[model samples]
Target: QCQGGYDEGAGGLLVSFYHLVKLAALSDRCTAGVMPPGEAPEEVRIKVFLERDGDLTIPTLYGLFRGADWQERETFDMYGIQFAGHPHPKRLLMPEDWKGFPMRKDYVQPDFYEMQDAY
Candidate 1:
């Protein structure tokens, strides 16, 4: 399982954060609603930082986590963070021809009249 898989503009850099959990370690007791002492799910936190002016790319985790397909694409669409080797690195929440990433801190919203024909 993964949580908090998103990007943010931090200072002059774009940072992406992901929290991953190894379900196998805690699967047996997940449904029981109780975790015995000394039993903890294996977890990892990953952070990828990219330059604002340089290439904003990171290795795709889709190969390891199949569910990450849309997450990566959304990140790309919103923050312009490219996931290298992603099978379908297309927009998930925006139009194919949309201009500029919407979630970047420096992003300037375009005028509605300017986007009338972009659809």
Candidate 2:
């Protein structure tokens, strides 16, 4: 019924493949929302727990949805949320060797901006 909503016998939140770049941070966590397609579109939100240094790995939908491939990659490139099991799982925007997650609230601005920068 909802992304994090109660579903009988279904544990854990259901993920929605998003068309919107609705990424945000909490006190110690991050969240993103994507629209799940159906007879009509429904909103789905995922709340992720930040691991050491703010790394978050989310399940990939590449096997289920085609568009997920690019969106998840872009999300990973921008927000640093790795889409686990994604076939290509590569950066869609930043350079391949770029360090740190730019979208993260606490992501430290690397002093070597001249070398690589999301700015």
**Best TM-score goes to which candidate?**
1
Q: 1-119, model 1: which lDDT tens digit per residue? A: 65223434545778777788887777775767778877788889888878878998889889998888888888888888888999999999887888998887788888772445544
Candidate 2 Cα errors over 4 Å, as ranges: 1-55, 113-119
The whole-model lDDT of each prediction reads 0.78, 0.54
Per-model TM-score, in order, reads: 0.80, 0.52
Native-to-model Cα distance after best TM-score fit, residue 57 in candidate 2, in Å: 2.0
- Compute the lDDT of residue 98 as modeled in candidate 1: 87
Question: Which pairs clash in model 2?
Answer: 18-34
Backbone collision tally, model 2: 1
Q: What is the C-alpha RMSD of each candidate to the true structure, in Å?
A: 2.9, 13.6
